[model samples]
Target: MRELVFALEYEPGCNRVADALADHPDARVRSLSLHATAEQLWRVDHATGTPDALDAIEDAFLTSDYYADCLATEDCGATQTTRVLDRTDDTLVLYSDWERTPSCASVPHIARDHLGESVLFETRHEGRHYTWRLIHSGEGDVAAFFDALEVAVGDCARMEMLRTADTTASVGGSDETQSGLSPEQEAALRAAVEHGYYESPREVDVGELAEHLDVPRSTLTYRLRRAEEHLAKQHVADERLPEDPSATR
Candidate 1:
């Protein structure tokens, strides 16, 4: 199988949902499940943020012009609905079913059209960026699909190709273990690495990195320390275990 990861950033005034996400940098949305067909698309999303942010997101989602456009009769024929499956002070579980039409040129539909119905999708939304990960059997017409996606977004959004590679190769070696790190820890570690916090000269300090991530310096430091300790333990464990038991004397 192959994995394709990409991101989209819609211009302001182009998509209400995107606008709400952009407005709340501290908020995050993740797709728990997604299934799309020619007739409709079903998605369940988990959102986390301040209560005010969650409220704004819910409001924007319920009355989004993007969803409205998909349900427009001029575009296609189908029923459209959304429900709040669950909610908390700072979290929300949302379910949406959108009827598809020719005018509905969403990523899922475009992917299904090009990569077939067997593809798996995962998505994350943060700040102004919406990222998508697609896993599919064999190498499908990825270039064509990207082209169609660009056309679909037209002048509204910018598309970025993040990664495209064989799933097995991308998973590192066969003995690679999962990093037992929380999402925040992983984010902190990633930002640190990307910003050269570990360079010889230390291109960025903890305070600067924390500021860049919009997080408290102490919080970022704690997360990075925890992540580093976890990874160090994993490395030691791997070193102690021989790939072949018989090879150990």
Candidate 2:
């Protein structure tokens, strides 16, 4: 199997959902499930953020056009419907189903055209960036897909190919594990460690670190806290003892 990881950076006003996320940098949306066909697309997404951010996201998804690739300027004869399956103080589970028209440009349709129907997709959205991971049985027409995607996006967004490798070769082991940190979280943690922010004599404060990273202090703090939380949980899991001690034997 082969894996392709890519990301799209949307320009302002390109996509309403993306713009909403950009407005609330602390909010993140992850695909819990997604399935697409030539005629329709169905997806379930999990979002986490403050109540206001979640509200904005839910509103955006419901009120805006639901083109998976981006926003559609002209009516493509498509229709979208959304539902809030669950909600909490800081999380939301959303479900959406959209009917597609031939004129509609979406990642699933493009992938089906080039990558075949055997491909699996996973996606995450944060700020103005949408990242995708695809796994397919064969190599597929990657170049053609990229070209087609670029044309579809027009001048609204930039597409980047992050990685492409054989799944078997990349799956197994790594010398340094991140304990499930997202790219943003990893960056925050790395910067903090390098700047001696964790040292007893604290070389830099949170505000200073945020300035160095060129991000808002609140955003930096959120990333750091999330990263630390993941690391702590991972450490506890690793050190956990089996309920039945004889299992070690």
Candidate 3:
């Protein structure tokens, strides 16, 4: 099984929810899972900053042409999902299943549809784009997948591939290569590594790193995630590249 993790950026012009998220700098959507069939169940996590931002999101979602249920929420935000349905402002009747309706063409929905039988993992929205991580049968059909996505977005947005890799085995016999990091990400990840943070939950967490660095916890979290992502991408790319024939020189 070949697994690929790619980041898909959605601009405001693409979809309503994406636009709402862009308006709120701190707001983000983390895709938990998507079960597609007669009726699609989209499980997602949402985070917002101010009351106005929250209100905007609610307006876009609750009034949407589907059944939505709020499962949980806290200071950070909430997690929820919408049952798949296709409705418009002009239509007052509601359909219980997607067969009777047009269907909502979301990024997650489109990507999952394109992949067909492949398994899709958790999808995350950092700030600008929604990151989708999935595993496929290694058919190598990335170009075709993006073509479908572009059509879904309707020329409103385009996707940028941040990272992709095959997870069947270690490409270079190691998880990561000798790559450098940005100043901020380096500091945060370095501190975690110093304490064996990745070693079976042995040493420390982000909070400890924050305390040690005298920086805010959120700041540290952002830096560490980005840094780790960079290292991981490098690892995948390096493993896929052909070996150097003149290394002895």
Expressed as tens digits, the lDDT of each residue in 1-249 for candidate 3 is: 665555555444444555666677566555444444423444544444566665555565655433322111111122233332332322111122222123345444554566655555666655445666677666646667777766655545445443455676643212233344444556677788887777885678778778988976655665677778777898898799887879856
Q: How would you encode candidate 2's per-residue C-alpha lDDT over 23-79 as one tens digit per residue?
A: 998899999998888788889999999999999998888887555453355778788
Q: How big is the positional error of residue 112 in model 1, measured in Å on the Cα after superposition?
A: 1.0
Order of the predicted models by lDDT, top scorer first = 2, 1, 3
lDDT of each: 0.76, 0.80, 0.53
lDDT, candidate 1, 1-249, per-residue tens: 887777676667776667777778778889999988887889999999999899988998897655722412233444568899999999999999987666666788888888888999999876656778899975578878988888877877677654566787833222223454555667889899999999999999999999999966645665676579778987898899758867775
TM-score of each: 0.69, 0.72, 0.51
| Clash count for each candidate, listed in order shown | 0, 0, 0
Q: Report how far residue 123 has shifted in candidate 1, in Å.
A: 0.5
Give me the runs in candidate 1 sitting further than 4 Å from their true place: 68-79, 170-249
